[model samples]
Target: MERLKKLMVGLILLCLFISCSQKNNKSDGKLKVVTTTTMLTDLVKTIGGDKVVVTGLMGEGIDPHLYRASAGDVDKLSKADVIIYGGLHLEGKMAEIFEKLPELGKQVLNVGESLDKSKIHFIQENTPDPHVWFNTDLWETEAKAVTKKLSEMDVKNSGYYNQNYEKYKKELERLGEYITNRIKEIPKNSRVLVTAHDAFGYYGEKFGLEVKAIQGVSTDSETGTKNILELANFIVQRNIKAIFVESSVPKKSIEALQEAVKSKGSEVKIGGELYSDSLGDKEHNTDTYIKMVKANTDVIVDALK
Candidate 1:
């Protein structure tokens, strides 16, 4: 009954938005792109440059996994020239809405879904991890995909988009090198990353860290007492120097794990907040994708070293 009611409300909003968009068909002569996560927003802005006006539905510290599209979000999406999102169920609650957008004639790009299946990491037999941005190589591929989409949509500005992508690609290469070097500062055994959730699996695999978490990939997943206890024991057994809290996930689970560590006669520090599912704001110097990843690397290296 609840799902039906929500669906009805969405349909009504979609109709109203479509009507309003048709009535006010004023063009700024730029492609209006709607992105689901801040990461994608930054990517589009970096590649699209002055050619696209990008609006991000999820802002800094917003968890995409638990994010549901509001009426305003639906309206924004309905009016977009193109909609791009991190697929692989990253935006768990908004999956249905994304599916319906293409049916409404909206050009939609599922960045994660466009990747080669072999490159994606599967946490379970069939469930692939959605946090591909952590792997710089994979993120470079996603950036290329975005460039291709923007060029296809705005052929006149294809050259401009390609140029921006080439420049940004070099920046990403530098960022990858920086991450690899910074991660090496930590001793091999001490390179273990303990976090509130399993969002850093890609980061761990990419940079050679062993990652453990009290919760699963999605923040919507529950954290049981047993899970917390087990993670705490692992931390104690490994003598991990520091654990991390995610910008979008609650700190309580990590805090509880800290208490469990204490009960087991070991201590662990909350290293620093890592930008897992979202980026930090400008005030924190992590507004851009490169800055966010660099800031996270600095935090991790500083804490674990």
Candidate 2:
């Protein structure tokens, strides 16, 4: 089945390359940008503005770790003038496809790879955490990188892109302040952020919370009974008020953890669903990257405070 899938992708790539070759210029006179995660999509859109057309492969509530690129996604990517993604294997299943795109002469940017290595958190040797967006300061770095990429691709509108970035930078600064103040509301001992997965490492590190998760960095990682029992014990001992469920991951593991805590004669509430891997839609007021971060912080602070 893996071989067949590869063959299909290969055939699709060939056809897309041919079709893309025939299109010498975009009729709309805008750079066509394709991004993997919603975070990158928002970044591109925020910087590119009217100068570029952006297409995001992943949507709200989608988990990038387990997201396999469909043929339709490949088609979109192959035709793009530039492709941006959160690298470090965040989009694990689509990594091979991303690798092949550059071979076909597509301009690709791995946002995570462009970061200063010293600022990154590694789960172990060479396994850097891909949840860098949760750290507002780190995310500002990514925003600057995205702005530079957009400017390079659309030189005519380089000034416009930089302008947008400067404006966005101020907003991010305000967001940083907001997060710091909100985090202060929670008592130091109660600043433990227990979630469904280890996606909040950056958030915890930046905001001074002790983050614990039932699963590892990737949602694809297994959640064994031993993991549940161990986490339950920690929660009980810490007297954690609430645990969070991720929008992209199933709540079963976290629900199971709550049950284990109950078995230990302790109680915990489900704080709220966090937008870890994806942003929420407009209905939830988390459609934009800034909004999503604010929403998640509000949820975490309210629960723990």
Model 2: per-residue Cα lDDT over 1-305, one tens digit each? 98987886687678667756775568999999999899889988998888889999998889999998777886787678998999987998777767777777889888897789999888889777899999988898999989888888888899999999999999999998999999999999999999999999999988899999999999989999999999999999999999999999999999999999999999999999999999889999999999999999999999999
Worst 10 residues of 1 by lDDT: 17-26
Each model's lDDT comes to: 0.89, 0.90
Runs in model 2 deviating more than 4 A are 1-12
lDDT of 1 by residue, 1-305 (tens): 87885776588556744744574463889999999999999999999999899999998889999987777787787678889999998998877777776666678999986689998888798777899999988999999999999999999999999999999999999999999999999999899999998988889999899888888888888999999988888989899989998889989999999999999998999999999988898899999999999999999999998
Q: TM-score of every model? A: 0.95, 0.96
RMSD of each: 1.7, 1.5
Clashes by residue pair, model 1: none
